[model samples]
Target: MNNQYILLPASPLFIAFSLIVAFVLNLMPWGQMVGVPDFVALALVFWNIHQPRKVGISVAFMMGLLMDVNEATLLGENALAYTLLSYFAIMIHRRVLWFPLRTQALHVLPLMLLAQAVQLVIQLLVTGKSPDWFYFSESVVSALLWPVVSVLLLAPQRRAVDRDENRPI
Candidate 1:
């Protein structure tokens, strides 16, 4: 059976809170573990798709700048990557919303890959050193996490229960 939910409008405070939380998660010292997903990218993509008006490229750029400062990389490396990610997510958000959660994950995979690719390219151009093959694994993990991210991010906006009676919502 199909169990679609009618989500309430997302709160701006909650959106900011979620993005901050994602940034904090990224700040955690994971010691460069391979396949460690970028929580900031995942959250950015989710919000960009779900609420394009609320979370746009400026937000992505700011977050990316924060990430660059935190990661000690060249400034604007992550800004460019995340700006492109938000742009791409916003571009196809309508079509993505038509798919099932699992299928949506498939669509998100490429966006994550694209963001990573942009950052990787910038890093290569600046440092002139190539990363290991495992560098791409982060996108795969982020893609695998799309469903979870969707559920968590949308939780605050989801209707608690469906009305079957006089509430024609």
Candidate 2:
């Protein structure tokens, strides 16, 4: 059996679970001085990098719309940012996936920054003023969290590897 071709179920349950987790994290009360990290963006980026075919631009856009509604920000601000971010992720998916986790983190940092910049620009356009630079701090925190998020999300696969290694070969 070709491991790469193995068909895993695209569990809607997991998708819903991820989105709910993201929403809950976003809704948590954080100080104005210390912006909350973007959990949805982190999750979306992790899934998109790991399962680009399943979590593509459309999923990102939809997630972004939900985020916009949840955050009560401009209607399309997050949607546009997410769509662009998803596209960028997909474009680099192949190369990014081949790198070490630390290297991948470096690669994704710019994308995270770009996504935040886009969202900030949209908010500025809508409100005629920019948000505090602190809001963009979430991207830095998100990038820092990427390796941890990737490890957590990839735990099942790692366990499967361990199981295979322990099996008769």
Candidate closest to the true structure, highest TM-score? 1
Per-residue lDDT of candidate 2, residues 132-158 (tens digit): 657767777787787787766765444
Provide the overall lDDT of each model, using Cα atoms, as 2-decimal numbers: 0.92, 0.78
Cα lDDT tens digits, model 1, 2-118, are 456678999999999999999999999999798889999999999999999999999999999999999999999999999999999999999999998899999999999999999
Q: Note each model's CA RMSD in angstroms.
A: 2.1, 4.0
Query: What TM-score would you give candidate 2 relative to the actual structure?
Result: 0.84
Candidate 1 segments exceeding 4 Å error:
160-169
lDDT of 1 at 2: 41
Local distance difference test, candidate 1: 0.92
In model 2, where do residues sit more than 4 Å from their true spots?
A: 1-12, 33-35, 161-169
